[model samples]
Target chain A: MEKIIGFYPGCSLEGTAREYNESVFSLAKLFNIKLEPVPDWNCCGATAAHNISKKLSLSLPARILSQAETAGMKSLLVPCAACYNRLMVTQHELFENEELKSEVEEIMGMGLNSPIRVLNVIQFIQEYIYPGLQEKLSSPFGKKVACYYGCLLIRPHDVLNFDRTEDPQTMDEAMKMIGAESIDWPFKTECCGAGFSVSRTDLVAKLSGKIIKDACDRGAEAIIVACPMCHSNLDMRRNTIDRLLGYKTEIPVLYITQAIGLACGLSVKQTGIQRHIVRVDWQRLNSCLPEKMIKEEEDIHG
Target chain B: MYYALYLITLLSKYMAKEIYQNNAPHTLNNDLFHEIGISSARCYQCGKCSAGCPMAEDMNYTPNTVMRIIQAEDRQMDLELLSSESIWLCASCEMCISRCPMQIDIPKIMDYLRQKSLQERLQDKAANKSIIPFHQSFLDMIRYTGRSYEVGLVLDFKLRSKKIMQDVDLVPKMLSHGKLPFLPDGIKGKKNIQAIFKRTLRKK
Candidate 1:
């Protein structure tokens, strides 16, 4: 039986975070997990919709949920943290209030009282990738990594209800499975000043600078993230971050899927590693892995 | 529960006083509290929300102070808070709500306040000139397309701010990395999405 799941690669995936989208698709293929993009999915309305209009925010996610349910998708995987937050918050709201749910149903022009679960990237990996990880491991990703959750991945605990809102460690555990060591850091769940990346680069710089400085000071080779906005703040705005730090910091930010894909022996091109603003030298990365795979061809030739 | 009752009593007292003191009726505080589904009257001003806030230093009024401002029901103070850098600087991280002993959703209140501020055109001119326009352009992008069209959004914001040359150098880099595409792709059923926005507006 094919393990097919619905996928929602929100706006960021289509633009500004293509690497995240590519790496996720690559990893899914490697794991033989069939991912089906939800039919004609719209935006999750992220932080903008809620601030602009409450009805639009709720109705947007409600429409996505209703569409996913109609498409026969029981579980929808949203890789971007913002998308997951909006979808989960919507689900929490609609499920808790019957009257609001009916109102949303009327607005969306569709029924939305279905049991559809929205999973963040980490949760999706935990369920689908962890069990088969040992068999797929080609080399241990040996470098020390700082798992950055940023905000919205786990906050408003009652609504998200997935990991510990203050100190989430699921990403750490997931990295450990791939033979990568995740360090304990204060800014793991800190706000990276997302949504202000373009409008207020100075704030993003100061906040993302502190996060990068902490990770680098703790001897992390790379910072792992699940959110595209976090990546943009930490990766795209590197010049601003470096200016605030008063020095150039070369700590590469890798999407969790990219990190996992590399560990699973997917080529750098396949994993979209070169698309990052901060470059990752795969040869150096190969030397950094804990355990080197002894190729059957090498053994036979030798 | 007793705290809730006492707070309600206090609020009712204020409401009664306002009704008696003026001929013109205004449901300013009660309507907001109702819209957000939170009882600001229950806030005892513990300051936990302020302490947890990462951007509190940038805020002219701290999260805790905003709660007091809302509860006081003073028209001037309300306008001040609505136009203050505090609401504009809020990252909407939900730390205030998470740490609040009263379990108040301060972000929801902030959202309401931002909406009101924009509607009234009372946004802090110096600080929010860029911020308000950016948010409007973002919503406009979603309104036209089903999702955020990054190029269009950036263009809209730049045109509004008239700072087109600000990030010009970075465009090629972004394009090279396939981060920003030249054309915006519209999803199927864009009309349906427009209807959703329109219906939501009508409801409001």
Candidate 2:
């Protein structure tokens, strides 16, 4: 008898990082774990929603959890940090506030299961997905890589409470399972200035430049990101950083899943390497990932 | 380019010594702060908000320090580059707001400072060139269309900003894999979105 957790991957799945969504699903099958999808979901109302109303901000994610509760899901597994934070905070507030639970029910038309649990993708994988996946590791990545968590995933302490939000690398623990090294560094949870990458590109570029510079300064081979928004700012915005800093800093940025997927015999192309602006063309990276990941493109496309 | 030079010149006076005082008549006075729903009086002067702000170390006055100034009801501090970056640098991740003991929505205050700074063009020295235009283009897109059309926003931001050519080598690959969409498709009920945006002036 295997346990199946309810999965709530946010809108990024619909675009940007479809591979992550696919990789998680495929990896679940490999681990003999079931990931049932939460039905009829809406946006988690990330950084944008708080501007509207704090109550509404928390309730948006709470509505999804409420749906999960109605469907009898004791715990919900969320992939995106922004979503994980909101959902987890709602769970925290609901359990803490007796009156608010009934108030939220009247607003959302559903109730959270008492003691409703919300786990980040990394948290869930580290606890449930790591052990079984560890059995299939074909290579070890002792490469010095900075694990970037950035803001909501770890901050405010009360919500999610996974790791030190400022300098978190719990992915280092999970990365170890698939046999990869996670460099311990200070810039892990530093803000990439994600949303502002568009509005205030200059600030984002300078800060992102600093983040990459810190990782490179510490001799990191690459930077691992879990959030698509973070990934976009840190990785895709490389050209902007280069123009601002007047140098080429082509550091590879991969979602943790892609790294694990590569280690577990998934292909580089299969991990969505092409979508990255700063390509990870490191020789050491080449040596750490398994041969299967390298040949994966040929196998799938040929 | 003019704004960037303008901001740098403002920070030029701070070259002798970064004075924490720049006197500019700001709309963020006591009454205005209340109008925006940020109560400076409630802030405990705990530098946590400043400490948590990603751009605080680089800023002249931190979000926490700004709150302290607003709390003590002292409005004489010079907050040029610091306030601008403090507000602009906020990713709006709400870390400061979430952590505040008094539960002040510092991010909103930060947005006000950011908008003011951008409007005044006072502290634009190191504005993320690519990031800002990308943001303006996106806002313009949303302003034109109710909700964002990711494909449209991406295409226009890149094309208009002249950055598409920089990444043109990679666009072929992105388009090949369907990572970049060909059309600008937006949310169905755009009128409702327009109403929302029209009804509420976020920082104005």
Candidate 3:
């Protein structure tokens, strides 16, 4: 099947975490999937939107959907966690409240073409990309990687029905296909001190530290997450977290697409793997992988 | 359990004090009340934020205590512990936000309170002092790019704060491990990012 995915990266991918943006696009290309970037899409407003005016935050994305509706795109592949949540909220609102749908439609000047399936990059990879590439993966990640799904991904689960928002395993299942073992860590759905990271470092440190420490305690080499804000907190501030606790833990954090892309023969540059804070300790991480697989990869390259 | 008793005793004394001569927790960060934008307005006197808080055990005043202070007719002055380091303990777990019946963003309010206290130099922990440089770098990057460039932000935070030496050992370990990328992946339209930040910061 020629699957054409509509990609909406929110604001993070355009520049901030180019790694995530680059990897998703690369993975799409490598898998022979076509991605039509939604033009003129704005910030999803994240939880910040709801916290302010319920209408505006949601409308920010609804406006984009109105465009998608006109473009005749069947689904939107939102890679960012906050964007996924806002997009889902807009979808729910359009279905639940005709008045709201019409009001939003009137503002955006478009009629709903169809019910759009908003797939967090996880769903797209798990269902379409993973099954297709099971045989051709030249190298598996070959390490114990922890999956971090903060509240936005699955929480308010009624909205994001792709998986158990609280204990989302879509990413985990996707990882297995690429041949990396997934570790069960407790902070999977914990808040990485969201918007609080700005107004309150004292709180963000304690909260973020716990997540990193939990992953480290499980003997995991790195953590993978989907939210840009969560990525900023866990990966960017791990050092701050360590400093806060008087400890030294150097676990790298990668966006889920980047990690999965890795297992599927994606390179560091392709996955935006280098744009991380707690830098990857590839030596220790690679030690866990079977030597036979490494030799095969080198042989393939040589 | 102990928290309930503490709050009640405090409330009773607040009522008693009000009857004698009215005052509220004067030490409560006034700026926070305005920043959360509802510290005085929307809190329905519901105690759900404190109730569902996972880190409440570590706090002196539950989330409700501060709300009560803002609502109180008398000096709930003892509630100053919010600035002392108790409220700083909140995990941003958002159980407070998820459970609040009134949907008052208590965690956010608590967060602002933490920031206020820190800027006032009211913090008690050592780790927090180090975060100033991180915050400086983060905001500057955001101010410069309207978004953060990870590698640039990290290096700037370290060098600017002199915490570069603090993690000196990790540098070699990470470089040898194939983790370190010497050059940053600078974003295009650096000027646009700078413009957005300049505009946002000025407006804010």
Per-candidate TM vs. native? 0.90, 0.71, 0.63
In model 1, pairs of residues that clash are none
Which 10-residue window of candidate 2 chain A scores lowest in summed lDDT? A285-294
lDDT of 2 by residue, A95-203 (tens): 8888877776655555566666788778877777667675777666656678888877876575566776555657777776666677778787677886665555667
Q: Give per-residue CA lDDT, model 3, range A1-302, as digits (tens).
A: 56787888776675455678888888888888888987645555454334323444445567667667767788889888777877887888678878777765554445675578888877777766767677757787787789888877775544566577446687788777677789987778777777555445557778788888778767787787887888878865676787886756677888888877877788888887776766676776543233455577789999
Q: Which one is best on DockQ?
A: 1
Comparing chain B with the reference, what is the TM-score for each candidate? 0.81, 0.63, 0.56
How large an RMSD does model 3 have? 11.6
Best by TM-score, which number?
1
Model 2, runs deviating above 4 Å: A94-115, A284-302, B1-52, B57-61, B74-88, B93-149, B152-173, B181-204
Candidate 1 CAPRI grade: medium
* Model 1 chain B poorest 10 in a row by lDDT: B23-32
RMSD values for the candidates in order, in angstroms, are 8.2, 13.1, 11.6
Q: What is the lDDT of residue A60 in candidate 3?
A: 57
In model 2 chain B, where is the ten-residue run with the lowest total lDDT? B192-201
Question: What is the C-alpha lDDT profile of model 1 across A1-302, one tens digit per residue?
Answer: 56899999999998889989999999999888899998988888878788778888999988888889989998999999998999998998888889999998888788986658899999999999998989999988988899999889888888888788778899999899899999998989888898987777788888888898888777788999999999989998988787777767777899999999999999888888888888886445432221222254356789
lDDT of each: 0.84, 0.66, 0.66
Residue A128's lDDT within candidate 1 is: 95
